[model samples]
Target: MVDLTALLADLAAESAQLDALVVALPPDAWRRPTPAPGWTIAHQIAHLAWTDHVARLAATDPAAFYGSVIAAPDPARLVDDGAAEFLAPSARLLARWRSGRTALAEALAAVPPGEKLPWYGTRMSATSMATARIMETWAHGEDVAEALGVTRTPTARLRHVAHLGFRTLGHGFAAHGRAAPTAPVRVTLTAPDGSTWAFGPADAADQVAGPALDFCLLVTQRRHRADLALVATGPTADEWLDVAQAFAGPPGAGRKPGAGRRAGARA
Candidate 1:
């Protein structure tokens, strides 16, 4: 069984890490653009806060959650709309994000075991929901770090994001309107501490291997695959790398080859 408590702890840590990055930013700094197309640092935090708000509703009030979804002006712009709705002064936005996330964590922890919570066109267990939050916090944290010219040290918390990326292989294919391959693809990654983190069948012929950080960046679409050092052994694995996405909804346009931190922290 998934350890919901441990996952929640990791979620908290990931959020705290990201919070540390932006907690003291000047008001003007909040307007800095991130790698995500039109998102500023403020937009990034607002997105997280808005997601936490709806996610809390999903846990505490299912009907209200669905109602909010139905009331969305445009489904295609849901993510951006939420971000814009939650935009505020730096202090208020920060406090809103912190409180919203805390409420979400509490709501999730109170959920009954085996119960699933409604999500964006899907449902997930409390553990899975927590994991998803960690992935987003870390991915967006990367954008925040890059914006501040800060290179964060990868932590074991990335294991959650990496695991999510590996588990979302089929989702990635389906999001692109392609059939997911039945063949298993073994992923062997070198963790931040130089330890091996392997997933999938041990004897699988198709394989992807690389630094855990790079894999997380690729799956999150924070960096172009061309800029990553991952090696795919089979055609399936190769194609999977090209279309991988850790987030739900549609496939992202993703960053260009040189759009990431290739040039410096400023990149």
Candidate 2:
């Protein structure tokens, strides 16, 4: 079982780091477009803030959140237009985002450990919910960081995201309208500190081996699979990498190879 408190602490730290980077950016930087098509830095921040608000609603008031946020007559257009709706002066948007993140953390922490929280796609335990939040935080932060030309230090916290990716392999497949392979696929990664981080059974035949950073990048849609140094063995595992995704909802059109890399960060 994952340590919920530690995960919350890491989530807070990740949020704080992103906050520092965004808050310090000059006014023009907020308006600059990110790697995500049509999304400016302001859009990224607004997306996070709005998602946090929705996450809080899911945890604390699922029925209400669903009625209002999910029940929108034009859900697709709402999402498509969402990043633009929360725009404010850079300072106000940042402040709103920071406050939303803080409240989200608190709201998630209040949920009972074994109870499930309703999400758009699936119900999640407190640990899973927090881990998903961290994954989104890190993944979205990358877009913001890349836009500002900021290089971030990858941390062991990525193990959480990598684990989520590996664990949710079935969800990724099903979300994309594909059959999920039943065979266990091992993932062996070299952590930042040079220690090995392995997932799945040690003796599993199907396997993926690479840097933890690369694995996280691939699953989060931050780095296209072709650009990642990940090696997937066995037919099922290889095919899995072809469409690996860490987040839920509809299978999104992911980044093209070399399309989203930030300057001065690893290729």
Candidate 1: RMSD to truth: 2.5
> Candidate 2 lDDT (Cα, whole model)?
0.82
C-alpha RMSD values across all candidates: 2.5, 2.8
Residue pairs with colliding backbones in model 1 are none
Task: Put down candidate 1 lDDT per residue, 110-205, tens digits, no spaces.
Answer: 999999999986899999999999999898889888878899999999999899999999999998999999999999999999999999999999
Give the alpha-carbon lDDT of every model: 0.90, 0.82
In candidate 1, what residue range of length 10 has the lowest lDDT sum?
258-267
lDDT minimum window of 10 residues, candidate 2: 258-267
lDDT of 2 by residue, 229-260 (tens): 99999987998887778887766667777775
Report the Cα lDDT for residue 244, model 1: 93
Each candidate structure's TM-score, on Cα atoms with residue i matched to residue i, is 0.96, 0.94
| True-structure Cα RMSD, model 2 | 2.8
